[model samples]
Target: MTLLATHLVSRLRLKHLRLVDSLARSGNLHRVAVEMHMTQPAATKMLQDAEQLLGAQLFERRPRAMVLTEIGTFVADYAARLLRETDSFAEGLDNLKAGGFGALAIGAIMATTPGLLPRAIAELKQRRPLMTIRLIAATSDILLEALSRNEIALALGRLTEPKDALAFDIEPLATEELWIFTAADHPLASRESVSMAELARLPWVLQPHTSPMRRLIELTLARQGLGSLDNRVETTSIFATLHLVREAGMIACLPKSILVEGVARGTFARLPVALPNQLGPLGIITRKGETPSANAADFIDVLRSMTAPGEELG
Candidate 1:
């Protein structure tokens, strides 16, 4: 290694980064000092030293609160990420000392959260009771980003086909079907089957504009000659979508599996409309070279075993 690279860490301490993170949060020296357990002058000098060490002024000091300069924001973000990693490392050490298995971070999409993941998690818990688990439910786009950042060890979500699959070890777990749903007491709920044209006339609750599901909704509506949905609520959160559809009499499109829990509780109803049934394969996505620890490997096995027989793991 170069001499500068070798000595760089020796010149910097974790406390400096902590001060930067704290300053970024409060933006006021007095409050930052209290949070860091240092005097105000000490906090101020630490900020100055950090800026000097980084070879740039990090914050623009105002009369009351300091505003982060462009570089300051970047540094703060890096510091925060590093701190999180540090804590995770510490947790792993603690777990090892306690005769416990290490942690596993998983990123799951909507389809798996309500159906596949819960059972697998329960089984993994029974097998590896002391393993720490962190579950983040989001879209494929977000999950892929997390996987790339090592924020998640593996992802259970949509898998890209041959083109993008080259960068990841993609496994086909299941095919998800979509459904149109609304509150149980909705005007159209008791009908035999409503036409898409008729349903499009009602207010809707839809996914965010960027989600693949939303694009499908738009495509389906466009084929029926409807310009756009009269949707006033757009969210990615399933809980919020359920509440809006259940209480406000709005309609939405979601994976069929996500409704099982709600439908069982009588909070939502599936509309008897023939919506699109095709979705690209949803599966386990891991980095091309990613290797799972023992805990994650066991969880992966449980996930595979939980897949329905017809939708076999591949």
Candidate 2:
């Protein structure tokens, strides 16, 4: 029985899985062939072989595209999961052979990219220059979703709120105070301190409404009895937000680290806002009870060292 199972799995080659997945995604055999760099006849034969092995018709042929039958959907989903695990297993073996340096898939919020991530990545490069790092910049919701799906090994961002509970572990790194920033010459830049009520009157360059940062800002404003600033300009681009704050004299809330260099260099000025509760926790999140890749574990060690004071490497 084990031999029979091994033979069946071997027959479902990576090439066959690729053909099926490509067809499912593109919904056409010719397009799948084009994508796989194969001839149409070859692609068709691969699909036929896959269907014959499974003993079922995988897709219903349509005029413009093919639709997966119910069984086909199940097969495609299982095939994808198998391929992902296979790739991960291969990476693990390769890392074990190469002195523990391997590939890592990381997800980070846009806010982390400018500061924490850059510092961590620089350290990682110095430690293992050949290590492969794939970064996906996204919101916390998206990152958490990817992490849960095992598409990414680790994530660095603000801690997700309680409503987003999942089977993951969070390691606190640092608590960064969010600061209001504006162009150097803006009127509020010279103020010794300003209340939220006073600062709420200005035009703001806000993060997307769905973002955790935006939600934090809104909640803070509401608690201060100030209405949410109309987002006349909404953007997910942190760089663009900085430029707009510098050139357009608009207000933006961002992590202190993101604006520290600029504030020091006089490109932008940190507003003197009384924000006692404007701090957010940044952390590393990973799936609970799952061992990370060697490279990921090493990188996490570096991250902990960088964020923690007086911590010796174990």
For lDDT, the strongest prediction is 1
Please report the TM-score between candidate 2 and the true structure. 0.74
lDDT of each residue in 1-314, candidate 2, tens digit only = 69767888777788888777778888989878888898999888889999998889999999989999999998887777667767877886787588666678899876567666888999998988867777988777678878766778999865566745457788877666677888889988888877778767778998778778788888888887878796458887788888899888899987776777889999888887756665456678888888987789988998887777422111
Candidate 2 — what's its lDDT? 0.79
Could you give candidate 1's per-residue lDDT for residues 189-262 as a string of tens digits?
A: 88997988887778888876656677777888788787788746877788888888988899888888888667
Residue pairs clashing in model 2 are: none
**What is residue 253's positional error in candidate 1, in angstroms?**
1.6
Please give the lDDT score for candidate 1: 0.81
What are the models' TM-scores? 0.82, 0.74
In candidate 1, the residue pairs with backbone N, CA or C atoms under 3 Å apart (3 or more residues apart, or in different chains) clash, namely none
